[model samples]
Target: MSWIYLDNNATTKMASEVLDAMLPFLQESYGNASSVQHRIGREANQAVALAREQIAQKLHVKESEIFFNSGATEGINTVLRGIAHAYARKGKHIITCQTEHKAVLSTCAQLERTGVEITYLPVNKTGEIALQMLRDSIRPDTILVCIMAANNESGIIHPISAIAEICQEKDVLFFCDATQLVGKQEIDLQRIPIDILTFSAHKFHGPTGVGVLYVRRKRKPIQIPPLISGGQQENGFRGGTLNVAPIVGCGKALIMTNLHPEIEQYRDELEKQIKLQIPEIMIHGEHAQRLSNTSFIAFRHIKAAEIMTALPHIALSSGSACTSGLLDPSHVLKAMAVSDDDAFASVRFSLSKFTTKAEVEETINDLAKAVSRLRSSSPAWQLFKDGLIS
Candidate 1:
């Protein structure tokens, strides 16, 4: 059976170019990046440095600002926990949105247990935090404002530029979890003014286990204490022997990323067809600007689990892959004022640069059949047909 992958937001398929770029480092050139005394080690260090430069150049950031790490989870933890510890004297308060990834939310929760005050800004029905609310939430003690560039589930893009400006005006550090936005959108550090940002490689056809943490080094030169303290790996910010192969792969993947404007067309077509076939479905974040590769839709009376079980050949998600196994509804949908039933019914279909129009058409047919078949059996769906519920 042929498979159609629509879970790019969760992780993308590694590109052949990225694998080719990483093979040398993984096989013969295997050496500790820190052990530069030997030729192989020097070569490894050089490769890592080139990888950093590639990423920096692609993202329009300085080379020194880029630090490689395990992934976005580590990067988020490094920024949040590191700031909480390093800047504790300045303030004990931080602000973040309620729909943030588990990395940001979990880190904030942990910080709260340690006596740090955290304010979770709520979103509207379209998954957007109000700029006025954000401006009002800033207290004198607020040190950091954490928000993502794009949501993992709904693909709703927060007003990152405006949010950064607000944080700048308030003199608070701003950290953007751009894991879902990095390759899908252009992030020019020179223009955005975001103090810190994090993104993973696997989200953009790079190998997993390696990612970037970009800390602004110019202008105000924000510095948080090192999250890991060892023998000066990652400029002493993260201390461990570098995973050179994946880093090289990440660089290649980033450099190879070319925004596919046509992806939005495909996504729009899919949503249009899905809505025509399944009128009871509600498209989450439909009013807001979202990533071109994503569509989050909820069938009113059919649960997402039923749809997934029916369409086993399609690779998609009910929500964030990290929390998909949990019985509870998605925190993202709940934050957007979605009903518990709607949240459970929501499904995310994220495309990639490599996704073709034919695959999208196939997916539409599969989804329509699955939804119709499921709704046929659902008693609640029958009640809706009988005009019992809206």
Candidate 2:
């Protein structure tokens, strides 16, 4: 009765290396980063600096460009609010997609209350926004365009590079929520013209309550008002005391994931096996480039929640963890024009570097049996059996 955990997207198991990195900070090195006089404060500040450097090294950006936040949700809110307040004179218009995380969408809605106009670009059937549509969405007053690098539910990767180019040509600031893609994919900030990028360390093997936001140094400094006004932490962009322990752990986890690159292949094999074993399952966002570790599958004639209950030996999700308990279909699926039936039956399987071939095999076997049982008892199957094919 060994349990398999396949919900990396929801959260990851903290890596041992990360835990080791944080141990000192939690015990012997417990000191406020903002303090100046004490040796403890100096040591804590040094650790924070090193963590910043490590995060910057992975993103290929300068140390000064990275800022730590509570998580991706905060990072997103900071950018949206910062941009709206800072660039209100430039334009009241903002552009994003319907598939964006609730963090981004909700922040945009909040901005709307303050008079900022928002345009949610529609995605194609493949769960990707058209480049031309993004290009057309930009107006003279468009201040920013926020789009996620990889969808949290469907695992679809957006055309960020193209979107960056469109923003660059139009001089519109580009913000990317890379929570699902960072550590799982290569993000060369030097090569890409991204103004702002957000990542949650927990998405990888890092500890929770740690996130990174990369602001392009070369881009013009947008006067983003502070979200939390207090001490001069995070260059005054984000205030209050920094969480040094989790930030250090996040840095260590990121470094470890980067060192071991073969996890991508493991994820690919898992997806291949699941597809082969259950060919009838409709794979959402199949036509687009997606995160290697994620697979969103819909078991037709079977409820996703029921399948989840039946497969207690494995841990997975129906969609985004934040929105899982709700009965509504994933906004990402709905944006891609997925039918209500397919959306309701969908399940998200996100693997990790620690996942093994044996585990994947076991998952496929269990899922196949579960789907078969559910389908056997399905009213849709009975209707089809009675010659009501339509």
Candidate 3:
């Protein structure tokens, strides 16, 4: 009757446990983390240290390797820009896929203006890039390979482990945008060994405005020039008064993270029901490995905006929240070679751990009715029904 939120990829409701952990820092523990001379400052510093340790433990990384920032966007900018500047002498070439988040793509675009050579790899219909193509794209001058572990729109999971191995063999640094991968699955940096990774707390039921950047140092050190220059903080990697409350919240959120199988079941059931009840619907990335909680569906002949408008009580997304306001079709869908009409028709429903079967069932019914009603007034749908168009 009120709202059925299925936009978890855009952001999640902060977990009560995370909020509880952050309260003390926001109130009684409020002190300058940089001021270590006083007791309050020492307490703040200890909380930050504990939070960092918690995140490190969850990621199977060292505390010294973790750096906190505003969120994944800032971390991405920091990594791409820092690498471009820090490794310019080594090589000005970077390799990344076209489906990367706007943060990565835009940063690469900016670097291109500065005479940096960026190779944008193409992905197949399933949104998975050919590993051989990636290997071939890597030149002797390639300093870094940047990619996302999971796509935010279609939820397609790339073969990051293989990509890592290829980069490792080539002795090139790799940066993974794991914002969509974090908290949804277990990550052991020791096993996969990504050169650098970044994630946002808000993507995993933690507070907004906080994120982590993991820089590898066990095998070969990664030197990233600071993006923000001010007082020495985050080991001089990020300079600012640490966001004590959100940092504490982020750590607690990561510690409490766990895989939810039932959410996947709900998502699958929702998709199955929608397909069974409605005709001419296509599931994007259905054949590929994807995040369990995401479902991107395109109802042919019906615009995604119209669908969302029909189901007013449900929270849904046409594409990435960052790019939603733009009238163009989703770039992610376009990259997968989807028709422009289907790209415009696509809707992303990202379930959270809190999503329930009852809500999912209700949504199926509501969506089916909305689509049927809209299609009745649509000439395109009539053409599709008559087999005049597909």
> lDDT of each model, Cα atoms only?
0.92, 0.87, 0.93
| TM-score of decoy 1 | 0.98
Model 1 ranges with Cα > 4 A deviation: 218-221
The estimated TM-scores of all candidates read: 0.98, 0.96, 0.99
- lDDT tens digits, residues 1-390, model 2? 679999999999998888989999999989998885898898899999999999899888999999999999998888899889888888899999999999889889988999999999999988988888888889999999999999988899998888898899998889999999888888888888899999999998898998998888763576667777887899887888899999999888887765344556766676677777765578887768988888888887678998999999999899999887788888888888888888988999988888887888788888888888888899985785678853
Question: Tens digit of lDDT per residue, candidate 1, span 1-390?
Answer: 579999999999999989999999989999988889998899999999999999999889889989999999999998999899888988999999999999889889999999999999999999999999999999998999999999999999998999999998989999999999988888898899899999999999999999999999866567677788888887778888899999999999999998898899999999999978887889999989999999999998888988999999999899998998899999999999999999999999999988999999999998888888889899999999999987
Reference-based TM-score, model 2 = 0.96
* True-structure RMSD, every candidate: 1.1, 1.6, 0.9
Residue 209 local lDDT, model 3: 96
List, residue by residue over 1-390, the lDDT tens digit for candidate 3: 758999999999999999999998888989999989998888999999999999999989899999999999999999999999998989999999999999999999999999999999999998999999999999988999999999999999998899999999999999999999999989899999699999999999999999999999855578799999998898788888999999999999999999889999999999899989999899999989999999999999999999999999999999899999998888899999999999999999999988988899999999999999999999999998899997
Going through the candidates in the order shown, the clash numbers are 0, 0, 0
Query: Where is model 3 more than 4 Å wrong at Cα?
Result: 218-220
Against the true structure, candidate 2 has what lDDT?
A: 0.87
